[model samples]
Target: MGLTQRALPDTPVGPDAFVLGRRRLRSGFRRSDTSRFCDDVWRLAPVLHQRQQASLILNFPAIPARFRPAVKVLFYALLNNKPPAGERQLGVVTIHGYFQAFKEFLDWLDPQHHDRFSSLTPVDLCQFQKHLLATVSSAKQRANHRRSVRLLWTWREHLADDHIPVDPDRLEDDWNEDNSRARRRENANPRIPEQVISPLVVWSLRFVDDFADDILAAQDEWLALQKKTRRDSHSGHGARRRLAALMRRYQADRRPLPGGTEGQHGINIRHLAREVDCDRQSLMAPASWGLIEQAREDVGVDDSTYLRTEIRGLLDGEPWLKRISYDEDLVVLVRILTAAAYTLIAYLSGMRDSEVKHIRRGCLTTDADRTGKITRRKIISMAFKGEGTPLGVEATWVVGRPVARAVEVLDRLQPKRQRWLFAVPPSSHSHKAPRTTEAKTTKATNNDLNLMVTWINDYCRQHGRTDHIPDVSRRPWRLSTAQFRRTLAWFIGRRPGGSIAGAIQYRHLSIQMFEGYAGTSKSGFRAEAQQEALLARGEGLSLMVDRHEHERLRGPSADEARVRLDKFGDRVRFLGKTPDDNQMKKLMERNDPRIYPGRFVTCTDNPNRRLCRLPGEKDMNPDPGQCKPLTCRNVALTDSNAQAWLQRLAELDARLQASDALAPRVRVRLEEDRAEIQAFLTRAGVLEPADAST
Candidate 1:
């Protein structure tokens, strides 16, 4: 394969000669813009938007004048060719960040060190590792710096003058690359706290389901009013009649006119000027002032100051907000509405920021049975993460009705001709100014999400409601788009039988995510969910072992439970410190397969005697739902399990004594059930023969 492969020549190719990292260059990308390309400003055909282009444009001139050739060659190879050792090709985004690590390496190296890589020695490499420690805050980041250095060795054949002399792979002592990988198995972003996500999602749903229609209606009213104002801006002659009509409409709606800074709900001459067909100067003059003040008084402006729109939003089964007006409030609501859609889609669907943004008009599809009832709802978006293609491959997310509803709301609220669901929202009520066609960038989306939280808190405070989005520590939880998907994975993984918000089942979510929803996974969710389950199991087992809860267990397999639990406890015991993720991972992966705990019993799993297994099932795990504790040889019970058995006998005793007489057959079955539990407990020594008289 190496002999047949073609190599890039030392002389640089034209900027237009098919950019390598992306599967294909963008159709609209001009081939003639050779200046930026020659400057090594690498561009990829963006999957969603051109947001990453700024990062891809490298400044080769910044490097020390001598070593530029080697660095350029290394980058070109990374960009255009399949990486050696069967490594996957780097994506455009990956290459963008990859260069940053190298930049740090070069900055520290080229200052006082050798001009070429071959001149670099072991001592110099050790010092570079030390430099990384002093400069990078994270151990994981320091390891990535060394990875870039290692790449210099990996591509040594191509870097004729500058190949790294020392092998980075051998420098395990200084860098500790293995430790970093194990420690950083999970994501770095903090999960959205329960208090934060609960109310945040509740309010977001409220905005989408309950408040969206009102906000959209108010937007239409405001836009129509603006257009009418523009047309009447020249009709100063009929200003009085127009003013009278406005006053009557305001009185009927019981809303005061847009207030001036002068007094509470008092009319502003400037507002009247825009409302009717006159200039501010004319409206401020004696004649217009006479009409405006009389209109204000006729509308009962002195009784209150709040000018609410006709459409009301709910709070505590009533309207949530005090008012919705047709001005900046409407614009702000649009922003909140977009944030709501984002929260729903991102949290529930597990789409990345890029995929979420790339969700355009008509992306939602559904299948219905013959009765016209919808069966499954799916969202069609592009996954850019693994795709080498310019425009990403089409990926589908089997989302719930909430996600479907949110998409509908987004389509309704989106500005005219805005293709993306999260495209930059209109800034003003008029929406006349043209904005960029890109979706809100990650930073912008993050800001909007936190703002959504802030908006909810303030709304709650004003309404005397206690169910606000709460603070995490002393302050509000800082939210970001990156946190949502990761948090949902953790949520789905741990609470398999429970519901997340109110409607969707966590177990169903796990299944959907494992099957159709691996946005990063091909199935990252399946793996993520399994990791969470293991973590939960580890936590439970740690508690049991630490407290010596296993010592009191009683059943057929009690001896087996004790021996297995002891081995696990001894192996995983840290030096009086909490085990971190790496140690926990090691323990979970290597823990004995025999001991599987449940609410009523622990299965010291002997698969041959397992009652829960189906006819041909050979899975290592025994099904807990189908557990037969009294008869299965694998069953072992903790001290708490006896209390449950005692409670069940008492309930059975009461049912037999019921005056509404049970049939003879029902009495016989109930008595037989009590007798069997009594026999099991008697053998396990958790019950006295005298106490088993129920």
Candidate 2:
């Protein structure tokens, strides 16, 4: 425990001194906190997180004593060594995992006959793999253990005497069978289901767009009162005189004294202090109690609340909030408003949780036109993902008006001194909340989003409304910050032309996520969106196959459509294990140039017979805008397309009925066009022979 500096390993791995701290540490951390990197006990906490997992430590003592020194030296090397694959240093959590896995191998080997890790042979590693198969059932966990051993072998130069002699993985054999089953590019966190997200977003926007003014107004009142209290702290005779004068004015107006809200039914003493320009102690003093009681009895008191902040927010043309009167009421409202702001920025901007939370106070920026109208808005913040550093790089999101307003509201929500926008929600306890950059941890923010949902539902029930965010199977969908980014990608992939309340444009939002939206084209958003697009395409085709909807198709490539769709349906079918997104991705890649569903006509793309392909364009996917629906050889029509054409025919008939609006020649042309469409439908097996002649 008391190992001196001289007793530790003399040579450092990276710097002159070893740097064992994490990459993404907060401010005020000193690398010197642990001088002896070779110490048996080393702190592994990189960032200060609220969870116990953040408090990880390396316990070399737990390993067999002979192996301990070798393990410690190897860890120091791994910690200092930059990744070979052009990544940042291994994640702190990942290294901890490696330590656990490597320990299992050493434990299983119990290689007491050899003093060094390098003494182990390929036969020994093969035996260890056998031990893993017998003991560990989970392929993923077993792969982790084997991967850790592989890491030890990979760093052989640094290991020197401790390095293994042969490749422990032995790629020629099926030793990697456990890892072979693993899928690539699959996210562990499930994107929120659509039913939950739609209503959840609607309510979140309701709080932000409809209910925010009332909340912010109440916050302003609180700040003003706080300013008044801070300005006049003393409770001397001068203060007493001011208090008396305040009471006199109250009496002159014949109005009752302000009462407390939030389940309290008494005159607000703090309100009196704020009004009278004195410390609360002055109003609370025993000697002044009698005078206050006398004034209260003569002038009466309002039993509800002191603050008369008018609620300016409207819902369905009426005030959303009944009254922002009570101190508790205001505090709760501010928190809900914060959650709402978090929701908007997270969902709409396609930002990760940490990036959204790390947004600084003044991150929002705008580009205005020459006439002073705003053109584009963006948010600048730190991006931790793929920046290859502990502290993330500065990144920008080209956002819309809603995201801009949310950032503005967040800037005003927290205390002015707070550096981070997502600071502690102001409450009676913290006295305007601390000015710290870190507030809600991941779990805390998750709880906040869920609680906001609960609060919203309670509000809707009280207001006798039916549009509450519905639960999935009698329970609310558990929300995390993880869901929003991927959920936005999903929506962007499937419904680019969709609109929410004529406010949120999915088409514009999808554009903003890609390379064309901003100069930050190298950002990872484009990949996420394209991945979701492929999944959406495959999912739609698979669903259509499942419903047997392709049976009604009428087109030149109808047989090819059925064959491709049936194969896609089989590939996606859950024989035993449901395929993950990554597996589905692989399936879709092989089945490219498949059916593309459209509103007007389903394109069963055939390259040779194609009519929409541009002269020089080599793109396999047909351009839907250039689609020759009526004459193209690729065109297919399902029952829905038939109905769509029928609706179009009815509309054309209505237009042709407008005799005053059309000349004889134009009417004749219209009739000919109608006849052409009717005949095409009849030839395509959509209508009977008599209707075609008519």
Candidate 3:
């Protein structure tokens, strides 16, 4: 065994030297028969050139070493091959997942087969698939594994070198069965229900308004304290020297220093700790010898008692500033103010979480008209979604007065050096060293919002307030970053005329308002609005169908409604629980019996007879707002519609009676309006001929 050693090269291997020369190569090569079997695997390194892929390759050397030529061929094909015309390069996550699946397969195959992966038959792959199905319980997981395996086989087949044995057509045909069983649920983002939002908004607004002075005063005190601390560090050498002398005397005498002992000059540990430059624990530390010496040189009595008396006097003068001295209390107050500002901006502006985080100082600007009057308040900030686009892609949200005030409050929270509007103190355990200016990350912002929710609930509980944000189902309504946008969209889409303060404003109904929020992603606010609309329509249809089955649909459109309901019932049987959009479209095509429950009208959408002015000549879309259901031949009125007309008629009668001294022409116009309502009521069988005359 000792005599079987290989000879070494004569020359030293420098950087430019050919280390693979005959003598050195023979000496360095593994003598085993299997060593050269898959030596070409190293050639695939160029294919896995991406940092992530290369790292994975280097880290998981076992996969390449065990699978040999097959692994190498797969990597080469994936790296060097161009994707099919509409396909994109696989994302890093996808590639990583495939690598994991291949590793798992190799682990399973190592014990069963001694041959290289290139020598395995189709039966081996079938066995692997069977093993995966038996071992993997999740349908999605199985699908992922199957997809990775299929891609591997496909790559092996496409390799120009024919290094791996694979039948591409046979593999594809055998793996044709569907394993993807994941069902996507609709309206997945949980919106803060209206009940919770109503109170949350009211409480938040009240907190901002009623306690504005308290909040501002606390913030100012915090700023003054920060400045005072800096000034003390630079100019309190005399004070420090006096305190050091007192500390040294106490240490030398092994007793309290004399002056205000009892009712005299004895220093209170608590008061001394507060007045000193260091924390309480640090003041008491053994390493305080240096600080004590420095303080001893500037000879004077400890002035902590006087400082405490002055602070108490200040607090007595302003009752609101009493609790501002407590660090914990000050932190809570700051958090409350932060939460209030965040809520106002998020809900009112309808900005995404990322956009909100990117909001910097001075983001709010007022736009003036030609007359120099401040006409509109706008928030100008960078939209991260358009990062790679040309300039002028930033989002500018037109906000109201409340939002502007919130921005102002946020501006005063951070130091002038801190540019971020939502800057927060760094965590104690953060990897990066703490800095005075640090902006809240998206995740941190979300967490803070959640903490705010908890704080609000806790405050309400302690104060015995009846107003508090309620929960959905039984769980505490866990607030998400997406909820702010979705909840706002839900309200605007469902209640265009709903009162917030007093009246419905045009800003609430503007299309551009939502476009700014939804423009951040391909499927943003518009998709959310559409989904909400669809869900609303579905719910209404379900209720209508239930009413029709109970023979409750007594109206002009009752017969037509019954026919449509029967057709929907038949389709429901075949389409299962929830029919997709395409299925619903096909079902609604013939006769097109779409219901406008909000307007109390049913439209049998006949383009030739349609009377909606909002849609163009070539467009078949109907606008419920402009629907002239009373005059259109395709319109059908239900009981609700009849009742609404009667209510309007009564209102008109009251107005006519109230305006008895009006001009004859005004009376004539009122009479004509009254006559139209009576005619419609009579035609719908809600009023008799005699009743119309009356």
lDDT of 3 at 264: 20
Which clashing pairs does model 3 show? Answer: 240-295, 241-295, 245-296, 259-265, 260-264, 260-265, 260-266, 261-265
Which lDDT tens digits does candidate 1 get at residues 427-465? 453345443335667877787888788888887788787
Task: Please name the candidate that would achieve the greatest TM-score relative to the true structure.
Answer: 1
TM-score of each: 0.83, 0.78, 0.64
Give the per-residue Cα lDDT of candidate 2 at 54: 28
- Single out the weakest 10-residue window by summed lDDT for candidate 2: 1-10
Clashing pairs in 1: 23-388, 313-319, 313-320, 314-318, 314-319, 314-320, 315-318, 315-319, 315-320, 521-524
Model 1 Cα shift for residue 73 (angstroms): 3.4
Top candidate by lDDT: 2
- Give candidate 1's TM-score: 0.83
Candidate 3 per-residue lDDT, tens place, 1-694, comes to: 0111111122122222211121111122332321111233222222221111122232245563445434544543454355544444553335656767777877887888545545667777777777877898865566567666666545544433433367433665344334232222233456787667676666556546555556556556544434333223432445455457656655664432222332223434444444444444444444553554343344444423221111221221443233333234455556666667777777777776656766788888887989999877778765543343311146777777777888887776666776877777321124155432235555555666667667778866876756667777877777666688777766665554455533435345336455545544332555556555655565456556656631444445556666776666666557666655444534555423455565556664556667775345635456667777667765666667667778888888987997868888898898898997788667767789999988
For the record, the alpha-carbon RMSD of candidate 1 to the native fold, in angstroms, is 5.3
The models' CA-based lDDT, in order, is 0.71, 0.72, 0.55
